[model samples]
Target: MSPLPRFGRIADGPPAPAGGGESFATLLAAGGARVERIASLAQADPPGAWYDQPGDEFVLLLQGAARLGFAGGEERALAPGDWVVIPAGCRHRVAWTDPARETLWLAVHLPPIAGRGAIADQ
Candidate 1:
């Protein structure tokens, strides 16, 4: 087995959103794993977009708060230190961000699952 590589602090820039306002920063990208730091508007209410990925995403809130709007019309509030697991192929988007402060998030994307099974189980 190959040894895991070590990385220091990673600085990310804004994400380019297809919509009017959205941005993100990519912190780490190696093989099937990717970590990103995101910052965005605090009062923007955007519709949930239909998007899919091959890998599952794990998001952790580092600062501020926001709401996630799922494709099924479900909304969930996320605060600092809050974490959520987003399954692959789930359509979602950021519905709201706290206007009081910048929303910081740590998102990790893992390799895609194979054979219609969970990636973690493999």
Candidate 2:
């Protein structure tokens, strides 16, 4: 069998199904860490819902726009090139994403308990 291609484009994934929120594909996973390519099309977290993930997430906005909400009522708007480091166990949600076009994101997820310190050490 041929080896997996080492180079790929973030926009190569298929779009989300109609009204199907976001789409994600694992690009790489190794040593307790995984990288993913996420695509959003006018998606937002349901009202009052929050994602309390077990692993930390580092996300980079590649195209379009988005808004993120935190548990303490803090919010941030992201544009192309903007990135955020969300600590594990942090309550957060995607408040909004542009509906006019597909929004792309590059996300990195690390194992539980291997949070901020692991990031700093790398």
Judged by TM-score, which candidate is best? 2
TM-scores for the candidates: 0.73, 0.85
Clash count, candidate 1: 4
RMSD (CA, Å), each prediction: 4.6, 2.9
Encode model 1's per-residue lDDT on 36-110: one tens digit a residue: 887755545545455566778999987778888887789899988899888887777788877656677888998
**Model 1 regions lying over 4 Å from their true place:** 1-20, 43-45, 117-122
| Model 2 whole-model lDDT (C-alpha atoms) | 0.87
What range of 10 consecutive residues in model 1 has the weakest lDDT sum? Answer: 10-19
Cand. 2 TM to true fold:
0.85
Model 2 ranges off by over 4 Å: 1-5, 114-122
Pairs that clash in candidate 1: 14-24, 15-23, 15-24, 42-97
Clashing pairs in 2: none
Q: How far is 94's C-alpha from truth in model 2 (Å)?
A: 0.6
Candidate 2's displacement at residue 98, Å, is 0.3
Top candidate by lDDT = 2
